[model samples]
Every structure is written in structure tokens, then in C-alpha cells.
Target chain A: MTDVDPIALAVFLFFFLLVTVLGFLAAKWRRGDTLDSLDEWGLGGRGFGTFIAWFLIGGDIYTAYTFIAVPALLYAGSVVGFFAVPYTIVLYPIIFIFLPRLWSVSHRHGYVTPADFIRGRFDSRPLALAVAVTGILATMPYIALQLVGIQVVLEVMGIGGAEDASWFVKDIPLFLAFAILAAYTYASGLRAPALIAFVKDTLIYLVIIVAVFYLPTQLGGWDSIFAAASDSFDAFNTENADAIAAGEVSGKGAIPPGAAHWAYASLALGSALALFMYPHSLTGVLATKNRSVIRRNAALLPAYSFLLGLLALLGFAAIAAGITVDNPQQAVPALFESQFPGWFAGIAFAAIAIGALVPAAIMSIAAANLWTRNVYKAFLKPDATPAQEAKQSKLMSLLVKFGALFFVLGLPLELAINLQLLGGVWILQTFPAIVFGLYTRWFHRHALFAGWAVGMIYGTWTAYNVPAVGDPDSHFGSPVATVPFLDIDIYIALTAFVFNVLVALAGTLLLNAMNVDGGGDLTSPDDYKADAGDVGVKDLPLDEMAPGEVAKGTP
Target chain B: MPDSTRGSRNTRPVWLLVALLLAVAIAVPLLVPLYDRATPTFLGFPFFYWFQFMLIPIASVLTYTAFKLSQAATRHDRAARGQKPPAGERGGVS
Candidate 1:
């Protein structure tokens, strides 16, 4: 009934400015002695401890995507939206098993990206190129999705004065926010994100905990609140009974009923597998000081998962508050403004804005690592120095930020969302090589190539055939699509993954049994369990020398 | 299979621990679906939601446990091999 308060807008801008200042200053907080190598620029000197790793990786993994989209999906769909929660839960155990091995291998080989490991492990440059290309491609849209989250929060706060502003004007807030991100990342590298993570996560917790308890009390008790939501869901379902029965839309205008369970499970699995494969997640893992830091962080990170559970519940709270907006993505932010005072709304907005920044910085840095190691050094300048590489990576990080900004502004909102879904499908193709390669060195290079190709093709086609709701003009161009026969909305990437694995197995056995050359192994079995003695860790204690090392290498 | 052989004595505990940890992690999600409805609520949220949420912390404890056990087991294996145990990479120290 009333316009969003200008005072609320001003306070929101003030908090956002504070976060940006913090983001810039972060460049100095963990300033490495030199920013020459990818280790310094790309990984913040690989010096993060367990608590910092938890927050950095947590801030990376739990982003504005989790804040805006997951709840948006719940507000729009229903039960299907809960996939994010389970996916994260499934992710920890999976990482618990695989990540230590990844750390050991990465540490052993001095590898920067998963592609680097792939290249070293199989001695295949072409495959490493594919992994690098895929990492960059998948990361760009994901960074854009973070902008979408910021856009939703900014729009909810009515930051821009225009009531019916042009599309560009509506997104100016996002552009300015990302510009700040680009600058800090270019100057500080991964440390910007790692340092800002402390603030971002703390703010997110404050906002969500307050909103979860405050909104319910303001509207009604939790029971009455949920009852109202259930009523709304029931009423909507009754009207759209045929659609509900047909599995098109659930009564809640949120998750449809027919394919909810399947969609939930598929999203959970697809997201879990895809999570670590992302360059940002890998960057976080690599930035840790040692295998134990990673292990300790893995144990401690469930606390963030606890925070995620609280964040997801904001959707039901929004529903209970009868919150509605032109864009469904604004459901949670809008709910906060509607229920809370001007000061608190400003704080909630800060959380979302800062939340977007942390991931964007990490993602940009990770993408830059791909460019420097996989693209630039691989092709442009093989003889490049660490300083030159760092300089080149800094420039490339800015370019990646702008690329994401364009995607956020130029594409339609739905298209941006779809592109990310497509990105998931695309990144999942790397799982077999990245995660599976850590434990067993058995998968042949030819078999992996066959698997990767099959997955990419099938996932793309399955996604292509999926038409948008009630859009005849749209066909292959859509990003997120329903499966051909199953008719469920999922990251088409997993479908491709399943097919790729099958083909790889088939291709490997068929080729191997026929005495086809499976190719050479770059690493032997002993390499898997090799310690610093093999890698030549200097300054070891004198008493514990291995068979071949100098006296200083003794433990 | 010799009772006195070093290979047989050393590798057993590492395998046993890996299997146990894997079983617990894999079992909770698979088994919880069976008794999810039977479990009662903690607060307003259901047992299903709580159990899934609980997995995060539980999994963390399991990982730290697994890591410690793996180190100990690896040391035993190295001792049997008549080599000094490898230095556990101190990952958390910046």
C-alpha cells in the first residue's frame, strides 16, 4: 500500500558502502610477502587455517544463490526447494572422503587447478584444457547468479529511485556492487574474499536468526503461520488441481507435486557432485595450509550447514507473512522489509550484499587461475615468470567480473537462471576426472574422454529439448530444461554424467579387452602414498630421514 | 596370511576404519528414510529435517575421527615397513 521508505534505502546504501570498504581493505589484511605466483595471487598464499577455511569455503559455497534462489524456489514451488538442504548434507560426507585425497595429490604435485592435476595425472594436455575450459565456462554464469541475488535484494529495498526504471537502470545497483568486487579481487586476490568472509557470514547469521524468530512473532505464532501457508498452498492446489495432478504446478504456486521428490533428489545429487568441481570450491580446498586444515574445516563446516537450514526456513516465513513481489526472488528480502524496522532491514540487506561479494571475489580469482595456468601459460607465454603470471591473472580477474556483469544485465532474468542450470550440467561432467581420479588411478584416459564426451552431449540434448512453461517459441535455446521422458525439472548435467560414466566403462572394457593401448600412467602406485620425502620437503628433523634425503630432511 | 607377517599386521586397521566410516555415512541417509516418520520433533521442525541437519555435525566428527585414525593407521603401516612415519602435513597452520 505504501512506497518503500527512502530512509531504509539510505541505510541499506550506507551498509553496502561499509562492506565495499572492508572488501578493499582486505587486500592488506592477509597480504602475502609477494603476489608473484598463482599460490599468492590465486590461492591467498595457501596459508588459510581451519577456522578461516571454514568461513572462506563456507562463504564461497553458501552464497547469494542459497540466500535468494533456494528460498525463491521454495516460495515458487514447495517441497522441491528443500533440495539445497539435503544436497549440502550429502556434500559433506562426499567431500570428507575425497577432499583429503585431492589435497594430498595437489600438495604433492604443486597443482593449482583440478585441470592441472588432470594434466599431471594422465599426462594429457588436451584433457586438462577441456577441464580448464569447462571450469571457466561454468564459473562465469555462477558469478552472474550472485549479481542476480544482489539485484533481488536491491530491488526489494527500492535502492534506485525509478518506480518503472529501464532494465539497465534497475541493474545499476548490481553493476556498482560488482565493480567494487572487481577492484578488490584485482588488488588482493583470494584474500579479499577470505577476509570479508568473516563479516559476510556474521551478518548473514544475525539477519536470518532475527528474521526467523522475529517475523513469526510479528505475523502470528509458528503454528498459525504454517497453517496459513498450508491453507494458501491447499487453496492454490484446489484451483490448479489438474496441474497438480498432472505434475505441472503444485497448489502453492511454488513446487509442483508430480515431480517434486525426483527433482529434489536429482538436484541434491547433481549439486553435491558439481559443488567441489567448481573452480571456487577447488581454490578454497587448495588455499588451506595442509591436509589436516582441510580435514578440520570439513568437520567444522557443518555449522554453516546449520546456518543454511535456518536460511531455507525464511521461505515459509515469507509465505506466512503474505509477502509478494513482482519478482519471486525478492520473497525473503521483501519479507524482511515488510516485518522489520528500517535499521534491521538495512542489516539484512548488508548480509545479502556482502554474501554476494565473498563468492564473487573467490569465483573471479578461481576463474583467473584457469586463465593464467590453463589458458595464458598453456598457450600465450610458456616462459612467463610468477610476477608476470600474477599481473596477467589480475587483469583477467577484472575481465571475468565484467563478463558476469554483462550476463546479469544483458540477459533476461529467466535466461540468467537457466544459464546457471546449464552451467551445473556442464561442470558435473568434470566429476569423474576430478573427484574419482583422487582415490583410484584406474580410469584410462581414453575411457575418461569417452565418458566426458557422452555426458556433455546427452546432458546438452536433454536440456535442449526441454521447453519453457507455455512457450512455443522457445526450444533448444533454454538453459534449464525438463528431462525428455521423466518430465522433471533438474540440472540436465547429471543426466549427461550418468551417460558419460556408462560410456566410459563400456569404452574402457571394450578397448582394453581388445588389447587396445589404454595409454601410459604418468604416476605409479607408489606416487599415491608418497610423502614429503618423495616431494623433497626440506627442513625436516634429523632423526626421521627417509632412504634418500639430506640430513635436514630428517624428521 | 602369516600371523607374523608385517604386511598382514599393518594394513588391516586402515581398511577396517575406512569401511566403518563409510558404513556410518552411507547408512544414516539410507536408513533415516525408513524411520523418519517415527521420530518426533525437536522444536517446530520435524525429525526428518532435524536428522538431515544433524548429519552435517555428525559427519564433521566422523571426518576428524577418520583423519586421526588414518594418521595412526598410516604410522603403523610405516612402522611395519621399517620406515619412519610420514609427517602429517600440518594443513591448518597458516
Candidate 2:
């Protein structure tokens, strides 16, 4: 702990405290009629305009883990890590086509979560329950990954876990950070992240712009950086040739020819499809005021992707700067500490720590929303009022945050990473129910459920069977697997998603032929086009009833 | 209802254009082997690195154009129906 730089620690603490105060103050920043409703607490009163929604969703999607890990992946692997850039680029256009429809319909019916939309669209509580449970489960590992991001920054700063310190003393910093985050999030719900997002994005853009332009010059410029990176990788590949020949280690440097190409493409496509399905991403989209905000932000949000490209280059710059750490995850922070002054490194570290705060807050809120709306209210207490729902969500938000904390502390970081990878694989299974159901009701409810189950089972089984190149005993070692019978390696998530869609299609036809009723559709095609201020839309219960009064809100 | 009908009809061409742009966006990046190389460097960055970076703004511009075209089509439909455009629609550009 004494190895931590005073200036950096001080600056980090300063920004952390500032955001904590902002988080508490956020409860009143955008005051609604009352705090006794899910709309106010869970979705920030559902009135965020384009600018705020841009910051919120941007801050949510481009998370702290991404800031740390994408570059870390580049540091560890080569061009394969660049998969993130394309995955993010393609995501906006794909979401551009569907998310506006989601926003319109969700807004029309005051739907609070994607599961809410699923329930309404499919008219099946059981199907919606599956989507909700998957969302909560997938989001837990993501929230834990954000904590890992903070821990990496702390470890680089030398205040993380000491080699010989007791576990309690070593993890005090992580616990402290999580405590403030949990307190503020419990106090303000989605508003905490919504307000803090502005600060997080500002710090991130400032740090990235400075690092992108300044770091390259400090090293021997971009050409030297690229040369140094290439030289290192070339040496590495040559050194590992015997191991590569024996398939003891994976090949290095960019996506190699042949099957690696399929791996890269499928990972990109599968991730793009899965990105918005995460409950946290939908939480951001649901917070916007109108349909056009979603569209407008889709256009503007690519600015972050451009920034991310610049950030990914920092990995090469780290290699060129001759900064080395035991963990590739520490590469960026190590680069900043070695190259920049202590004060600037502190600012960069604060940008990342605060970065973790924004998403962790949103993810917990999202998970809590799922629990309150889908699990608790749907199962335990169908008669729960809005006030009761908000109360349960706030409590569950705290529980979810701490659950992620326990996850980071209890599991090996490798296993945590594996779980997060599995999160992506799991969340994509819900796409057929949520995304496809937005456009049509052709898929039978039972068929969608069966598809989700099959996708989950196949994805997990195949992912579990994949062994690390050097360690055959290590299961779930990679997101890519053989495409089964095709004998080409592709992203396991995409393969499972293909199976998901097929089973759904076949089952729908079979179920329809058997004359199984596909349940009722509550939303009309016009509902998908209903924007804010549209006439005769379903009125939000909050607007119709007095605050704190129990109203029978439409499911 | 008639406004929405007109809105969909007028935006059909714009949607088709958007679909084409999106197709190109997905295809160029998925065809990884085409630009997955060390040569053809720009500003000292490899072709693999620079080509993907270049796609960011292209995607952004295409998306923005589609958004504007769709909005304009919707506004035209609303005007034809003698309804004023939504208030939030006007101030977004600035």
C-alpha cells in the first residue's frame, strides 16, 4: 500500500468522492412527482432527451471493463482483439433498425424491462420469465467484470491486494469503492448512473484524446510503435512454433488465414446481436424520452467507437514503451504510470474507476428491475403496488451489487472472465423471443421457450467442452469452437444462435400444425410506431393515479 | 392511423437505402481476410488496424443520413395530414 503514489491516490479519491456526491444528489436532480414508482426510480422517470440518453447509453455500453480489457486483449492476443471495434460498429446499424421499434412499443405501454415487452408481445408469463431470468443471470458476471476493471487499476496503483496482507486488508479498497457505489445506487437507482455518466464520459474522452495524440509522440511515433509490436509478436510466434505445432498454444498475431476467419466473423456478428439484449443496455434505451432519441443516439454513438479504435492502439503503444506487467490487463495503467506524470495517471485511473461505477450502477438497476418486475411481482406478489415494486427494486439493487462483489472475491479472475464470456453466450439465446417478437407473433410461445432452452444447453455444453490450447483440462477456454460437422472454427455463440433460430422455426411450424394456440398478442403493429405524445396510447399508471396510490397497472 | 400509413409508405425508399448501407457495413468487416494484413499501412498503422478505424465514421455517416431521411419522410407525411411536426423533432439538429 505504501508503494501507491500519493498524488495519484489523492486525485483518484477526489474524483471518486465527487461522483459519489453526485450520485446521492442525483435523487433530486430530476425530481418526478414522487419516488414511489418504478418509472421514477428504475428508469429515471423515462424522460431523458437525446443528449442525456446519448451519454447514459454510451457510458453504459462502452464500459470500464471494455476500456481496460479490449486493450488488454490486444496486449495479450493480437489483431483478434480488434474484433471489438467492428462488433461495436455493426451494432448501431442493427439496433437502428429494431430499437426504435422497441422504444416506441415500450414507451406506448410503459414497459419497464425487455421482459415486460416480451410478456406483452407473447402473452406468456413463462416465456417472459425465461427472458427475465436470463437477463439477471447474464448481467451478474458483467457487473463483476466491472469490479475486476477497478481492481486492476487499484493493483496497478499499488493499493489493491498486497502479496502478504490478509485478505480483508488487501481488498479494503475494492470494498470501499463498492460500498459507495451501492449506497448511491440504492439511494438514486438509475438516476445515479445517468448523472454520473456525464462525468465518466467526459473523463474518458479527455483521457483517450490525450493518450492517443500524446503517447504516440512520446514513444517513437506510430510507425515505431507498430514496428515494435510487430517485432515482438514475430518473435513470440517463432519462439512458440514447437508449441503451436503440437497445438499446445494458440497461434498469435492477427486473425490467421482459414478457420480463424470464421472465428473473427462469427464473434463479431454474435456479439453485435447480444450487445443490446443485455438488460443494462435495454435499461439505457428504455430511459430515453421518445423513439427518435434512440435513432438519433444510434447515429451519434459511433463517435465512441471511433474513440475506442484510438484507445485499442494504446496496447501497441504500451509494448513500444517497454512497459511490462504480469497481467496483460494492467498494460494500459502500467503505460500511464510509467510514461505520464503521477497526476495525469491519477486522472486516467480515476476515469477508469469512475467508469466502473457508471455501468455497475446501471447493471445492478437493470438486474433489480428484472427481479422486481418479473420474478418478485410476477411470482411472489402479483398484487404488488408501484411503491412496493420500487422498494423491492432498490433493495435488490444493493443485493445485486454485493453479489457481484462476492463473485469477484470468491472466484479466480480467469473463471470470472469465463463466466462473462458465458454471459454473452447466454444472453444471445433470448434474442428470438425479444427481438423477433417485436415484429411478429408467428413463433409459438412454447417454441420460443424450447428454442431458448436448447440454445442455452448447446451453447453451454459446447463452450464447456472447448479446452485451452496448452491446457486440455481447462474447459470453456475460448468463445470459438468447431462448427460441428462443418469442421470449421466459429464463435460458439453464433453456432448456438443458429440452432436456436432453427429449433424456433421448426417448433413454431409443428406447434401451429398441431393447432396449439400461440397465446394472444397485446400489441398491434401501430403500437410499434407510437411515439411520445401519441393519442390514445396506453397511459402510464403513474400519470393516471396519485403518487403512492396502488393502481392496477396493465401487465 | 392514416398518418402512420403514409409515414411507412414515404419512408420505404429511405429504409431500403438504409438496409443497403447496413448490408455493406456488415459485409466489409466480416470479410476479415481482405484487410487482415500488415501492409497497406496508413499513418504507420497496419491495414488491419486502419481499415477498421475508417469504417467507424462511414457507419456513423450512413446511420445519420438514414435517420435524417426517415425523419424528413415522417415530417412530410405529418404535414400532408395537416398535423404539426413533433416539438422534439425540430430542435435535435442544433
Candidate 1 residue lDDT tens string, A116-178: 789888777777888888888777778888877877777777655364778577667686667
Clashing pairs in 2: none
Residues B6-54 of candidate 1 have per-residue lDDT tens digits of 3426567665876588557545653433423414755555565666777
Cα lDDT of model 2 by residue, B1-94, tens digit: 1233454245566567767876777678788878877788899888888888898888888888877766776676556656557434755542
Clashing pairs in 1: A76-A254, A77-A254, A77-A255, A78-A255, A237-A251, A250-A256, A290-B91, A425-A493, A541-A554, A541-A555
What fraction of the correct interface contacts does each predicted structure contain? 0.39, 0.60
- In the range A46-91, model 2's lDDT, one tens digit per residue, is 4555465445444544555566777777776544677778887888
Residue-level lDDT for B22 in candidate 1: 51
* Residue A231 C-alpha lDDT in model 1: 71
Give the lowest summed-lDDT range of ten residues in model 1 chain A: A546-555
Candidate 2 docks with a DockQ of: 0.55
The number of clashing residue pairs in each candidate reads 10, 0
